[model samples]
Target: MDEQNKNLILATVLSFVVLMVWFILFPPPEDTGTPTAPTEVVQTQDGITVPAAEEGEAGAPSLSPTVAQSREQALAKSERVEIETEHLTGSLSLTGGRIDDLSFTQYFETLAPDSPMVTQFMPAGTSDAYYALFGWTPAAGSVPFDQLPGPSTPWSVESGEVLTADTPVTLVWDNGNGLVFRRIISIDENYMFTVEQTVENNTGSEVRLAPYGIIARHGEPTDLKGFYILHEGVVMSTDGELAEIDYDDVVDLPVDANERAAVEKKTVVENGWIGFTDHYWMATLVPSPGQAFTAVTKYTQATDTYQTDVRLPVVAVGPGETTSSSTMLFSGPKEWETIRDYQNDLGIEKFVDSIDWGWFFFLTKPIYMALHYLYILFGNMGFAIIGLTFAIKALLFPLAYKSYVSMSRMKKLQPEMEKIKETAGDDRMKMQQEVMALYKREKVNPAAGCLPILLQIPIFFSLYKVIFVTLELRHQPFIGWVHDLSAPDPSSILNLFGLLPWDAPGPGSILAIFSIGVWPVLMGVSMWLQMRLNPAPTDKTQAMIFNWMPWVFMFMLGQFASGLVIYWVANNCITFTQQYLIMRSQGVKPDILGNIRGKTQADSK
Candidate 1:
């Protein structure tokens, strides 16, 4: 309809298209070393599948691939055995470190019990350790497949290592070179398993290295519920006018294993952060703000093969020195305090996704904290909201008083303004000149009435963000019927069949909705009465604009949080009471109260 609206729609369309493309191309790569259905194993002349053992079978392994080879060539003349690198446990094999699913849980119904990623990442489908959000590569560069034989040595694990909380066992593995990698795993009081890994180069020459991590989501993308996912650790508003797709839809990226060539062709990041997202909830692994990190998706194929490609934060490291990284996994309900506590450690609080108040946070945070304390005392967020609103109104009462007094004094001078309008005829500019001169002589500041309204904008926006994103109010209930202030009212119904989109929530026990309808009507009635008491805007267009604000606001804000509606209703009622008291041109009068009572009755009808 307008240039702004058109641009907004275009921007939204472009964003969704990009997000769609990214989603398809960036399938998570998780390699679960288990072979999907072994097509064929090394076979003997007897037609038996050799080399590959059956499930649960134990074997004494030998380094030579041809253990039972024909006794030809006298078994290489029985040469003296020598060790290249002493075999030991190393970094857990990442043959299939791919994320299969992602989830977040707030309820205790799941085993993780209010943790976001309980079922998704636990019970690893392929390996013991999961490396996520990091990318992998051949140590020096791309290794020539022709130059190296696959699996001359297989990564190994020992089950009887006996790892315990008191005495964690060391894991060692040879990296096909003289180098040995070591790591230790231990259980913590919180019932969490923690592992620390270190790479040691026993070889005289420098060894090559590749770094990565693993994460998973258990089900298909859309089937995953309650959990919200963030792309590259960024979440945007997905509702209202802000709804959009982050991946470009016109072009899809190759996520299937067959598209492996596409990955090699594209430049991948070396390090960054990636994780599952829950709305007011957060599951993130953030590096220091200035430090760079890569966005990686580990995709596992049906064959149980997985690989990781960096999407961002690309870097490289050189020999000998250890490059250490930390991954702090959170599987709990989204609590702002808890999230904030870890902001410094992992920057996880950034995932809490609070609306940035910018410079206004200095003023608003204190006010919000005080309101939160009151909520704690009352045990009702709705009451706390009401109390905070009134307190703000009371603090600004003097300013509001000045505004109403100026308006009232202007009402007495309306006849003069009207005379100016009449004499000036249709020359609108000349009429304003006369009105300003009259106001200047009367010692009235025409703009003084606007300061209160200006001050409320930031306050209004800050409260709106806090209400929408604050975990404190996620499932909090109010009196009568409203529960889960963070979610839309379940009782509200929409009849899309009508197509005009005017379907409203039917009258229910919700004080919020009821108060909303009643408050607007009250505000309108108060405005009409105040119009009769105070001078109207000098310009007819300006007066019409002011006159229309309440109705427009009522329609737009009808379904808003009951808490916000209550504040407006209270503020209006208070303003009306104050206006009526001060309008009599003297001390308290019976007529003023009688007029207000009549207006209230008329409005109720």
Candidate 2:
């Protein structure tokens, strides 16, 4: 086949692979786990669960058994200690000392001015309950259940009233049996909260218990994107290895009889953290770096709840000994900078991996860092994406220059190729031999033109995952009608990019296929312009395929994140400029207008 045919095939295969592979993996691989939910709990992971502690040492604030309740009712059941920080605001439930009412004060649900703030950690008993509860999992027969702080143990404010960056709060609960439990909770300027669990053992006997942290969600996230590209379930890091378990897979974990939940447990000899990760937000239990712990992913079938637990080493508290354990909870948007700081400064192992960087993390990480800095520099995520395209093009310039020069030389040899074709008419072997000889004589590689695009394949998917998964672009605006960069362009072609007053079909509707957005249309046009820089292929099939490839890609990506579409358009425009200049330098003026008008090289001559 001719160079045009190669280009045509390369372009087609590249686009399809990107689409399939970057949903991370098409139909994602089936995980190795029990296919069905655990029937009956026969055994539990060691150090995971213990029998009910004796009823919360009688006098401590006690509540009736927990049942489903509205968020307001749940909040009302326990007096809350308000949490205040620069980026976070929530409350600690005094009843359970749970960080159960958190919301990002800076992030909103929509572009509307009155949009509610993005909330996380709704109180337990609420329909969409999510919370981080910390306490001890007693060693079997080590201590009475009531002696340790359990989910419903009411805590009295022992220190600061409101938890803040400047004021950490300490809550205390005594079992009256000789165990006095104190929890000191502190938050930094960002999202991480450090909880120190201290036990004052007064009894003459020794108490053995393991401190544990739990992040439990009543059900799957209501806003679960369920997009194969995004992970909306349990994400954990064990001893430098990262794992993501979908809600379904978590349910399939081997059953633990004592906990009556499907449980998957791994002992992390050193650093590890575990929790649920949404598209933009996450809530995780981060143990101190180098702290060995048992990481558990659990799904309680009885309550339809999903949980990630970090169980610390068991501590032996002798009479008059005060033992303590410290762990952290990260609950908020998965901002690259914030998570990175925790990883680099505070030493939370691979915390930034908390964002789904996908398989192309090698490229995604750097691309995101560049985009993040660009956003900070420009104060606009859309511009940051465009800057990112420029950066990538810059990096690939040497290769792209060679590819364009090769294409330019190929165009110059087009007339000779036509003569060769005429001379060898129907003698396919002779034609192939002559073409190869011509390429060798001219020092031109027929396949060199594909280098830049081939290189673009991974970069394209990497950028897609970065823009689609990062929180930096969420609700960010570029220009008009593109209010949320992480979302598809809201402008619709059915209405002439919103020239019509009516709203276009939403992404959920079938009509969405016809609802190409303004940015995607521009992407198509840019792609067409780039392709036009070279003469159309003589083969009608290849010509038709090349003609439609851009528009086809445009529609396919119309429903994708706007930031990615912007990046593609920028990339195409840059490539067009580079090719136009390089070809002009090589002394072959591309007849772009003629190509756009469907004029082949022969017709142009």
Model 2 ranges with Cα > 4 A deviation: 1-67, 422-430, 595-605
The per-prediction tally of clashing pairs is 56, 5
Q: Can you list the residue pairs that collide in candidate 2?
A: 41-257, 53-145, 53-146, 54-145, 54-146
Q: If scored against the real structure, what TM-score would every candidate get?
A: 0.55, 0.89
Residues 380-427 of candidate 1: C-alpha lDDT, one tens digit per residue: 987887788778878888998887777656656666777787899998
Q: Give the CA lDDT, 0 to 100, for residue 227 in model 1.
A: 18
TM-score of 1: 0.55
Best by lDDT: 2
Of candidate 1, the 10-residue stretch with the lowest lDDT total is 41-50
**Candidate 1 local distance difference test against the native:** 0.41
Rate residue 554 of model 2 by lDDT.
85
